[model samples]
Target chain A: MPPRIQIISILICVFLVAYVFELVRRRHLSEEYSMGWLVTGTSMLILSVSDRALELVSELVGATLFTSTLFFFGLLFLMVICLHFSIRISALTKQVRTLTQHVGILDHEKRNLEKKMHQAPWQTSDSSLEQI
Target chain B: MVTPEDDRAESVSYPEPLPQAPKTLIIIPAYNEGKNIGAVLDGIQKHFPEIPILVINDGSSDNTETIAQQHNAEVISLPCNSGYGVALQTGFLYAVKNNYSLVVQMDSDGQHDPANIAVLLEEAQKDDCDVVIGSRFIGKAHYKTSFARHAGMLLFGTIASIICRQKVTDPTSGFQVLKSRAIELIASDEYPPDYPDADFIILMNRNGFKIKEVSVTMHASPDKESMHHGHKTVYYVFKMFLSIFVTLLRKSPKR
Candidate 1:
């Protein structure tokens, strides 16, 4: 890798790791999900700091440039994360539909109970007696 | 051969205890059908005076809930616009909770004749039938539909018939009667949300549930837009085929 590229990547990796840590600390992200980001950031940091590691990984990835290997892995990680989000969204949609169905049915039941309370004379008299 | 106990045992088989009378609940899923809901409710109420009616208002922007309430039908209003399948599933869930033996689902567009409810229910009463679909194309009923819709229905119906080994004349019919098993199925995790048409029938058949069809009279809708208009037709076909294929790939219910 070029000298300038090495210095910039190291800085970016440091920033990414620190940001992920901050998010987890502030409760914006849970530790379980943050593990993926933290792992990516650490791996990038190690590659930027050690040229030997990058060269070996690039050979395995069959990339002419070591930086291309990093880009390829980063793209792959993003695709996997997007697919995970899609699955989570589908589950949430089903949950919302079920809850909406329950809400409608429960509302109907509540209205029926209220109607019965108003129609029954004894209940009305008992409420009036309590008020007195 | 001379033993009296052996003779008695060979001659007679004990019968299971009898089931109580089957109770029916009518579920109508309506979305902005305030214009036509009144007459549909009235027609059904006139025909079946004692049966309970439930109108699922799918977050209609119009006065559908008020109209259904005025007609003395139980109205449940979703907080937001869930699709047609969700509304019907809501009714099924309600039925399962309330101990209803059967549920008849109908459209609020008034296309389905209320008098046809009897034919569907009678078919569902059979021991082998779990679902009774009221088809407009069966028998000599001459109901007219748009060319595109008719073609789509024919294609899907043919596919369903081939897969299920029975003639399915109308795969997109919104009218049907579901027995207790079918009602519990729609409420369970087995069902998918939205567009419970041919795919649902295929799923149920694969799960060992019997599907029967009855000929019924149908009239063209007065106002609602056709499902096969333009862009929607493309999406409907693609999503429908994909779900059908996926349903085939999934592990079927153990009979």
Candidate 2:
């Protein structure tokens, strides 16, 4: 709305975009997930630099106040980001569950084999003989 | 009418004889059931002495693993709590790997009566079903529960019955006997990770697995608060509805 606020918003958007790119470059974040942050940061930068475009978007969204329109879009962007994180979390949860199950079974089998070996070292040789 | 045993005998009298006794493994999934697991394991051992028992201790803060091992049940300790579904699936994987022909899943909370395991085993041995569920609602057994939980079970049972195209009386019952076919099928990645209740039954049915229910007695859970309590109950209802709805919309899973 004001010139000073617009300048601060542009600065923040620039920093956000740079940080997201840095993360991608470092391979800390995958390109698939970084796309949302990149779009949000670039959109904010564009809207902040162009007052006419902001006013037009506010009118299109039927908001009487420009700040309210910006807040609305910000909230909408946040909702989308939250939804994306939730989907990723769901996939990770499934993967973690599968891994945990396998690990538990394997650990159990290893302990059993160790105990059997301790009890009867000769039994192991019988199995090896059978294999031969 | 010829009895099932007599029919089996008559069939065996022919060229090909009946298959040998199926190797059965009892799997008990325990989570924070340290207080009750010992007695449950003892009961199973007393009644089914020859059958091997395996307990999947689901990363309980208590001494569930110790108690299970002390009772002579093979303990598979999960590194962390991964919920009931994952623990049970771990047991399924173990059964498949060990080449067990039948797997009997019983809770470590002492709710499921070990005496009724024979009923489930007999029903499973009929050779007509891939899975046999031990149901509490079908028999003279009286299992008391909170009104909300009972209502939830009824709701899910109705929905699962409609989707499964069969009468599902106790869709929430966890005590079951799975043949090798069902065991192999569930060991796959399609098994639900959380509450594997009515939605799972529908999935198995859609996958062409024959499911049969036998009446069984059960004791009330020792814990005052169920795993599905106040707010958790609401989330459970929402999650189950979403899961069942999505499952219905998806293409039928291959056998």
Candidate 3:
């Protein structure tokens, strides 16, 4: 790989790591989800800076060019991160659904209690709402 | 037209009615159904004045909640637009929480006639049936549907029929009645979150619940498409298959 491209790659990795850290500091990104990105950024920085590491990765990946090997690993990292996000999103969707239901139920229960307060115990018809 | 009054069992003739306490609760899950909710509530109210009606409003942008409230029906408005299954599970949760002995869940659309509530109740009263499904394809319902939907319904109905060893014609029918045990089970984690159609019926059957399908007539939905339309139809089919397979894979939560 040309020194120019390696310099650019190193700068990008530094920027990625700095941006992720900034996001965590500002609370835009939580540490739980940022771990993958941080690790990927750090690994990319190391791969770019160290020629020995870059050569070994290129030979292991059977890539003629060092840059292609870097690109392959970068792409692989992105795919893994995307899959992780997808899994998190699905879990969050279920959680949100359950939360929404509980909110609706609680609201209804509050209203029922208020309505019951106004009515005499004998007059209220839906008195069995609590036994279950 | 079989009206709710026709063969509507009175409280006195309930075949061992529970001490006049409100045992039966009708749960209506509605989403953007302001147009027909009033009439639906009125029809149910007219026939069964004693039974309490609760409507689970799925965060409709329309005046569905207000209309349901105006009809003197208990309304549980979800905070946001949720699926029909979520709205339904909410109703089941409410029923289970309230200790209602019997729960009749029907569609919010005008398609399901309030008159058929009695039909379901009668079926449950006759035997130890935990779930009474009001089948549209049975007998002389004459309910019309799109070709794709009809095919899907037939496919699942056939699957359910074979498994349950009963003639399950309407696996997708939303108009049905559930006893407390059935209601509690559906509301639990065992129930699928999205479209709870054929898989749920089969799940109940596998769990040792007696499911009875009674012939009931339903009107064709006018100016309204099914909830499983467009992209949702594909997802519904895929989810239906996956959930059915999953239901079979999992062990019974309750005997």
* Best candidate (score: DockQ): 2
Clashes of each: 0, 0, 1
lDDT of 3 by residue, B132-205 (tens): 98888877567778898899999988988887888889887888888877888978977877866889888998
User: Which residue ranges in model 1 land beyond 4 Å of their true spot?
Assistant: A126-132, B1-21, B226-231
- The reply for model 3, stretches above 4 Å from the true place, is A119-132, B1-22, B163-165, B252-255
Ranking by DockQ: 2, 3, 1
Best by TM-score: 1
Each model's TM-score, in the order given? 0.89, 0.85, 0.87
Candidate ordering by TM-score (highest first) = 1, 3, 2
Fnat per model, in the order given? Answer: 0.96, 0.88, 0.88
Task: Write down the lDDT of every candidate, Cα atoms only.
Answer: 0.85, 0.84, 0.85
Per-residue lDDT over A46-71 for candidate 1, one digit per residue giving the tens place of the 0 to 100 score: 98899999999998889999889888
Q: Could you tell me the C-alpha RMSD of candidate 1 in Å?
A: 9.9
Residue B64, model 2, lDDT = 92
Query: What DockQ does candidate 2 have relative to the true complex?
Result: 0.76
> What TM-score does model 2 achieve against the real structure?
0.85
TM-score of chain B of each: 0.89, 0.89, 0.91
